[model samples]
Target: MSTGQTRSDRKPAPVKMVTTDTGRILRISPEDESARAAVAAAATPAPQNIDPARRTDVLFRVRRAEGHELSSWWMVGAFVVTSGLVIALLSWVPYSA
Candidate 1:
């Protein structure tokens, strides 16, 4: 530690480490604008080292789910049905005149 050093002069921990249920080590970092890009770049596995099914993007799981052919239709239908049901039930409720 040097007395002349300002806060910015010190780089924060590269990444905070975590242990998964499967006993694999993971490095998680706060992903603000600057840190997100930097962490993504740093965490990208080498071509030979990566699993083909895994992705490093922020919404990897969502992106994968988004690939379904009927996902959008299902989402829209669910919203319409739920809202319609709620509104219909409320409309039928007896209100004090």
Candidate 2:
């Protein structure tokens, strides 16, 4: 799944291809105004202005139980009850005469 901008979406920038002595080709973007602006925009961090009330609301919604959904405590209690019943049944069974 692509989450951000794709290469095909952006216009291809003019680049200089230089061959090194080690037979390696390097594609370098020109240090122009547009290139500098693009670099600056990419380097800039996104603003994060989170409201405490909004955060609490989101957290509450996440923790809120829906209909037919069992809580962790209920599941644990059921497991403990089933285990006790199994143990009691096994103890009552006579293995030897």
Candidate 3:
């Protein structure tokens, strides 16, 4: 007895709604793949600049640790011993500079 298409029998269309600050409702029903792709691409995040204060703080921390001197005699001794071993290793190699 029913002559019209029922809601259960019909395929639903894509509904996208965006609201503006001026009380405007934008209802967009994109009909093509290119329009959907354009919307998707536009929504992607672009790169932003580093905060100057944060960057300066990081740079300051790096430079703050730089000028502090360490009297590391033990480390120097270990390095000299390692260098001697490397020199000895190089002596075993034929025609090495």
Candidate 4:
């Protein structure tokens, strides 16, 4: 009764428009064979239904260290000799000069 405006004449509320894809156009169809193959290949492989009795928890390696065994033996011998000499000197009481 105040302005005499009809319902059809009322303007719609403005919407805050936003594009998630950065306004770039892309053409893709589900019927494309390449897209289907890519989706399948990128998916994780399904778990196999194997017998639990045949399962193994052990892992084996055939690799060897690059260092020589001779060097290790030399290090052990040196440590033993040095320790023995230190013990002998500490155990010996000096006869005062």
Candidate 5:
């Protein structure tokens, strides 16, 4: 019985076999290789003029947040609510002897 999927009579495209410098064989489609090359060329950024003297030695700095303090009241409340819910659910379940 057919699964309602139409089978194409067209043959599969031939793939090109390439040998890498590391003696590895790769089977790549011509269309895929060309498209990959095109993408790589497009993704390459142009070189920008950078000043050597103006370059900062520090890459990033980590600092503490000012006036942003966390309170433990919310954590305590959430814990109490979840514990009460678990106890309630356990009590609701019928105990089997």
Candidate 6:
């Protein structure tokens, strides 16, 4: 830190433009410009080292699907059995002459 210069003493830093070999102009911070330049040189990956044949197939188990279907059927069957029991209990009565 400089004793003579404080943050309050300085106006905002000016933007900088850099020209690359491809004729592209990029605006960036002067303080971080060197670090960014170093990164750009080594940032590219070797295409030959990457295998383009890689693929992914996501599959759900057929057994799990069937089990879920059976479970839903069982739930409906339970509801029917419960309703039948309730009806049978309500209809129960003793006949007296």
Query: Candidate 4 or 6, higher TM-score?
Result: 6
lDDT of 3 by residue, 1-97 (tens): 9989666966678878764333347566766556656655666443366443355335543322456755589789999999999999999999997
Ranking by lDDT: 5, 3, 6, 1, 2, 4
Candidate 2 lDDT, 20-86, residue by residue in tens: 3333475667766575555446554433674433454355434333675556898899999999998
Q: Candidate 6: minimum summed lDDT over ten consecutive residues — where?
A: 50-59
Clashing pairs in 4: none
Q: How does each model score on TM-score?
A: 0.35, 0.28, 0.27, 0.24, 0.32, 0.27
List model 6 lDDT by residue over 20-96, tens digit each.
Answer: 53335777787877877795785664455433333123244233334455557788999999999987877775552
Worst 10 residues of 2 by lDDT: 56-65
Candidate 2 at 11: error in angstroms?
22
Error of 5 at 42 (Å): 14
Q: What's model 5's TM-score?
A: 0.32
Better of 2 and 5 by lDDT: 5
**Best lDDT goes to which candidate?**
5
- Cα error, residue 17 of model 1, in Å, equals 4.3
Model 5: per-residue lDDT, tens digit, 36-64?
56654655453356333233543443333
Which scores higher on lDDT, 5 or 6? 5
Identify the runs in model 4 with alpha carbons over 4 angstroms from their true place: 1-70, 94-97
What lDDT does the true structure give each of the candidates? 0.62, 0.62, 0.64, 0.54, 0.65, 0.63
TM-score comparison, 4 vs 5, better candidate = 5
Consecutive 10-residue window with the lowest summed lDDT within model 4: 15-24
Poorest lDDT segment (10 consecutive residues) of candidate 3: 56-65
Alpha-carbon runs more than 4 Å astray in model 5 = 35-97
lDDT: the better of candidates 4 and 6:
6
Q: Which is the better candidate, 3 or 5, if ranked by lDDT?
A: 5
Q: Taking the tens digit of each residue's C-alpha lDDT, what string does model 1 give over 30-89?
A: 654475456556663456654445645434433245556455888999999999998888
Q: Candidate 3 versus the native: TM-score?
A: 0.27
